[model samples]
Target: MASRDLVTGKIFSLQTIVGILGNFSVLYFYLFLHYTRCKLRSTDCNLKNLTVANLLVIFSKGVPKMMAGFGLKDFINDFGCKFFFYVHRVGRDVSIGTTCLLSVFQAIAISPLNSRWAELKVKAHKYIATSNIFCWILNMMLNIILPLYVTDKRNNTNFTQKTDYGYCYVMEDGTVTMKIYAALILCRDGFSLVLIVSASSFTVFILHRHKQQVRYIHRNNLSPRSSPESTATQSILVLLCTFVSLWTLSSIFLICLTVLNNLSLWLRNTSALINACFPTVSPYILINYDSRVPRVCFA
Candidate 1:
């Protein structure tokens, strides 16, 4: 128990600090770089959207759990619990949606100069901006129902029949109804997953074709023009792959947590931490790839 608690505390501390610094660095770069240029790329706007969602996630999920690790578990009220999970769900959904938008936008932006998508690339900024707004509105509405089912453990301590997860309480009014809600949430997430896979597939296909063309041109001239678009696309690909892997692993662990009987507190907390790990991991990917961030740290 001591070792588990020690590990959990250290991990939580690491995640919170890394997430704050990394996401904040991304935000700062966008501010300075975009403001100085007095222009924003479509990808930059989408990156800002993603960074903001991740910051929301870190604040909502990471901070509370960090506090929990430090033995401040009773600080949250019922409303706090509901609000935490609500924000957590919204941030996660928005992150997925923004990633899909980024992939789709990049695929459009990097289309062949003569292709139909090239025309859309000229107007990519408007499309990306509109999509970010739509993602925020859509995710907010999709997760609004979350608070109804989640509450603080204080409320549950009075009820002997309640199910508590150390930090929060789930008041299961009806098993069937909860199952239906879970299915709906899963379906929503599944739809987002499909969008990401489709967009990523399209991006990959376009990049492959572009690379072949570049190779042919380079063979002729013995010089290749590297594309800013391709470099950015590579970064997005890393972000997409990392997010999907973390989300998938977290989902698998979640499924097991539900199916297994009398799960240990360490297992339960670790699974929840895994779900929060993506935000911490993703910001660093963006920062490492982005040119605007100072090069000295990476060096």
Candidate 2:
């Protein structure tokens, strides 16, 4: 095994382990809250789904990349490749949709009574479960074709136009059908990006206004303790920013890989690393900001 493979394998191993632990902790914390009859927020459902989706992405993508990095060549069959890639793509897309939904929901949750979003604030919580179900269904349907393009690397050694992802190969036929599917995926992600950005911007504006009001009320000294709403808003903003930055980086690498047929091992691993960043980092971010976590831990 090359030194590069050894190094990447170690990195993936650490990342996957940490990500799994973090997400599971968050999921368990939320589940405990639910079963113990604790007061739950409307957006708790969204957080639960987000953690699950993040787990899917980490398991499906991170595990395979980890295995491949360990120099496990031709270990996966065509079916395995298809299944893993299909799950990864679905999970990836769903994560995006859920994150967007969470941001929009948070924005509405904080909207002023007279604002246009105020009406949505009343009904938004009721629709969160339905929205999550719809997100899963839509992303699954969109990514169902992904398996058709992926196959175990050893099986398609002769293909001239293929993206070798270490453990598996994505055979691109350069067909109009493939192009159309790519465009559709891009469009879906683009729409989600717009929603997330708009919602996040609204949240920042609200937070700014809130701070201004607090300052006006207590001009001598700022409030010693942040309000629950302010803390939640700040945390969600941080999470959203992290997601967007990492997603953008991963997308750039993905587009480059799509356009370039030749295998670039460094690029492939780097992309995988970037893609795993959010799932690995996001759970801890939530845990840090959620006050309930400390209580639950000590209880």
Q: What is the lDDT of candidate 2?
A: 0.89
- TM-score on alpha carbons, each prediction: 0.88, 0.96
Off by over 4 Å in 1: 1-3, 113-119, 156-163, 175-177, 220-225, 295-299
Best by TM-score: 2
lDDT score for residue 113 of model 1: 75
RMSD, one per candidate, in order:
2.9, 1.5
Residue range 1-299, candidate 1, lDDT tens digits? 36666677678888889998989988887777765674556688999999999999888888887777776667899899999889988998898888878877877776777987777878876777888999999989877777887878766345434445667876656568667778877897788788778878888998888687677677778656456556678889899889888989988988887677567888878787887788888888987776546642443
Give, for candidate 2, the lowest lDDT window spanning 10 residues.
Answer: 215-224
lDDT of 1: 0.79
- Please identify model 2 stretches exceeding 4 Å from their true place: 220-223
What's the distance in Å from true for residue 163, model 2?
Answer: 1.4
